[model samples]
Target: MPKIVDREERRREVVEAVFRVVARGGIQQATLQNVAAEAGLAVGSVRHYFESHPELLTAAAREMVHRVEARVRAQRERLGPDDDPHDVAEEIAGQFLPLDAARADETAVWLEFAVAARTDPALGPIAVELHDGLRTVAGRLLHRLGVDDPVATEHLAAVLDGLALNAALHPDRLRPDAVRAVLRRHLAQLPGGR
Candidate 1:
């Protein structure tokens, strides 16, 4: 009898390998060979899961988006009726910041994918979909905090994006505490801020 392999699990392993490559050397370095080596598998095995580099990259990007969306939803669920609106806003926004090692890896890979999407037509749609989803979440956060102005929602999204990028790229300078402070300060300026 032959052993059975979990196809989805194998695919996830390959996708995670791509993330490791992207985190270390950007999307350009995340070749099938590199990913295979990272995943401790043969290039042929990697190809068995994904036919092409674009297919692998797209799968990795989709996984990243899925993980981030799940994290955001978890943060939203943590909100309580008695929680201060300002604190709630800061907590939700902080979900995107690189506050720890795992989050830093995810953010780094996401940043790489965003840049690669600019040139890779196949990745462009996934990148745009992630962006729009994030914007909608930000809009909802603003509305929950009583910020009714459309301009304010847009500005908040930009601020969150900038903060996440800076924190991911310069974790030493923009440490977790610093990232939290920046988000808290920004939330303090909102309409219902304390």
Candidate 2:
């Protein structure tokens, strides 16, 4: 008899496997064969879920965005309306920073894909979508905090992006606590922050 597999769960597993593969050996190593091996499945099984390598990469990128958005939603739910501006800003923006091993892997994969997307037609649109989404989230979050200056949103996103990249590339130098402190200090300088 054949085994039964939940399609969505299997796809999630494949996406996770792709992350692991990319995290360990960069995006170029996230081939179907490698990802299949990482996921403990046959290449045919991965193809059953994705039509092609580009399709698989697209799925993984979307999955990363979905995971981060889910975390942001959870953090927003925990936020108290009366919380201090600095705390609120940090709480929301912190969703983008790589604060742990898992997040460091996520950031690393994103960086890898973003660079590859520069020349890969299949990944270019996905990269642009993710980039625009980042800006939209930052804009909304900053706007809500009464930060009318347009540069504030860009500044916040830049700070988070730089911090995440640094932490992902140099985990030993910039610890999670240090990332938070740097973020908080940056937010404090904003007009409506703190």
Candidate 3:
């Protein structure tokens, strides 16, 4: 009897391959053929999963958002019962920053795909969805931190996104301490700061 392949698992494998190729060689180099090779599957097999390159790229980009959400959710669960929710919120936000190897790879892959989204109509919606998801997460965190002003929370989230992207591009210019300091300063300016 032939072995059965888990379709969902194979799809995840292809998405991960897409991430790896994009991280290593940018979006232009992450062709369907390249992804199929990276995933150790036949080109036809990959095509069986995604009819077109745009379909695969969009799926991979959305999967990236799902990956980040899962990571943050897991970290939140790891927090002790007595742990301050505000601190956890900060940590969750920090996870989006490319401070370490794993996150750096994720950031690199995301940046490449985001640039591609500018010209790829099929991928644009997925990129927008990921952006909105990140914005929502940031807003929720700020609100949980006692930030009552929606405008202020939105601005802060935008600032945080800018800081992370800039820092990821120039690690030496924006150290983790500097990033943490900025976050702390912003929190201090909140309604009830310590």
TM-score of each: 0.96, 0.95, 0.87
Q: Rank the candidates by lDDT, best first.
A: 2, 1, 3
So what's the TM-score on candidate 1?
0.96
Worst 10 residues of 3 by lDDT: 185-194
Worst 10 residues of 1 by lDDT: 85-94
The 0-to-1 C-alpha lDDT of every candidate, in the order given, reads 0.87, 0.87, 0.82
Poorest stretch of ten by lDDT in candidate 2: 185-194
RMSD of each: 1.2, 1.3, 2.1
Rank order (by TM-score, best first): 1, 2, 3
Residue lDDT tens for model 1, 74-190: 887888878877777787777777888888998899899899889989999998987887788788888888888878888888888898899887888889998888888888888
Greater-TM-score candidate between 1 and 3: 1
Q: Model 1 clash pairs? A: none
TM value for model 2: 0.95
RMSD of 2: 1.3
Q: Write the per-residue lDDT of candidate 3 for residues 1-194, one digit (tens) a residue.
A: 99999999999999999988987888898888999999999999999999899889888888888888899889878876587756767688877877677787788877887788888888888788878877787777777777767687677777777777787788789887888777767766766665
